[model samples]
Target: MLRFVSFTLAIVAMCNGQIAVERDPVCGTRNGFYGIEGNCDAYVECRDYRSREMQCPDGLHFDPAVAWPNYPCGYPMEVDCAGRGIAQPAQPSAECPHLYGFFPSPKATADECGYYRMCVDGVAVEMACPPGLAFNPSNARCDWPDTVSTCNAAAFLGFTCPPPPVNEIGELIEGPVNYKYEGNCFAFFSCEEGRARLLSCDAGYGFDPISGRCVDGDIIKC
Candidate 1:
């Protein structure tokens, strides 16, 4: 359960004389899939107003550092700087689902399986359900063993051998997930002792997918 202190500091335009950055509502065009990357209602932009030529290296994405200098905005996983300048495959690189917190791909959509990834801080880590448990996408949380309508044993034997989930709107949960509650704070629903349990976010907080934490509801992805 990662949380952030209340965001009271205004988003001032901090400029280093060479690069000034701020979070903007303008969408970022990364990986082929578009709409909005992760829960980021705004993208970080560092530019030289005179020419807008400033940019982060190819391997790195812009980070607003809203949390502080500790959490640099970008991919949670390490980037191979050496791979820069190489012709990338036409397809988008495999990446964590920035939309849902910072979930990596292959589990972003959250299928019949009972496991997915949760972005704690800026790193994407795998979360599993309890023993004899699998997540029911239709219910939006963990459920009894073999309860999901799409649990394909042949397709998955190790992913959910025993465990967790992701969150979405009215769509199925697929796994344990943390989501915004009624346009307010964050609430994560999971299975405790074979029953569903909903955990509310701390006061004055909401789930922000871009940063992958419970922050002020000023920007709600849900």
Candidate 2:
């Protein structure tokens, strides 16, 4: 009986290992292999393979549990599929957004997580997000940054002229540099003497130093 019990445990261990190898999404190693952390869903998380802590793949890393495919770079958001900004069931006829206009094949099963498809742009490559994420037509892709907060950051564009140096004139202060938080563009500037300041607008349109060039003080328009 003890011999039989030992054999059963061995079989179970073998099966689990096999599944881990086959289920590995990134690199499929042969029978005696383990996995490491990767952006792709199929990869197993092996912390130390042979003494070295596995670094994140070239373009991938472990994502926070808060977001699916947690390492956020640019994955389509759910709203791209359904017109409404609500989560919808993943269906067979589901169409994905294109990079320029091309997209990957439909998911075989909802469990697949994400898809890898062609980019419509001339890049001629395939991109992917975690399963369930989709491109947003309103913003163009799942990975597009949120614009609302970006737009709000325009408030940061206040005023600061002298460009520092205690009180030096003719310093040829550098023109405003545009810095964006999300989609919004705020001004960033450096003085010729090495001081910096922020530029902003009050009423109508116009920002300090270089006033009223672009409306609404936006560094990036839309």
After superposing candidate 2 on the true structure, give the runs of residues whose Cα lies further than 4 Å from its correct spot: 1-56, 69-194, 207-222
Q: Mind giving the per-residue lDDT tens digits that candidate 1 earns over 1-222?
A: 122222222223233232334433242322111111332222343222211222332223434433322333344233222323332112222333232232322452324365756544334567766533565545435565345566653243222222333346554346343332233347643343233443455777776745546777676655
By summed lDDT, which 10 consecutive residues of candidate 1 come out lowest? Answer: 27-36
TM-score of each: 0.23, 0.18
TM-score winner = 1
Per-residue lDDT of candidate 2, residues 10-52 (tens digit): 8998988742222334323222222232223122332222222
The alpha-carbon lDDT assigned to residue 197 of candidate 2 equals 29
Model 1, global lDDT: 0.40
Each model's lDDT: 0.40, 0.33
How far does residue 10 in candidate 2 sit from its true spot (Å)? 28
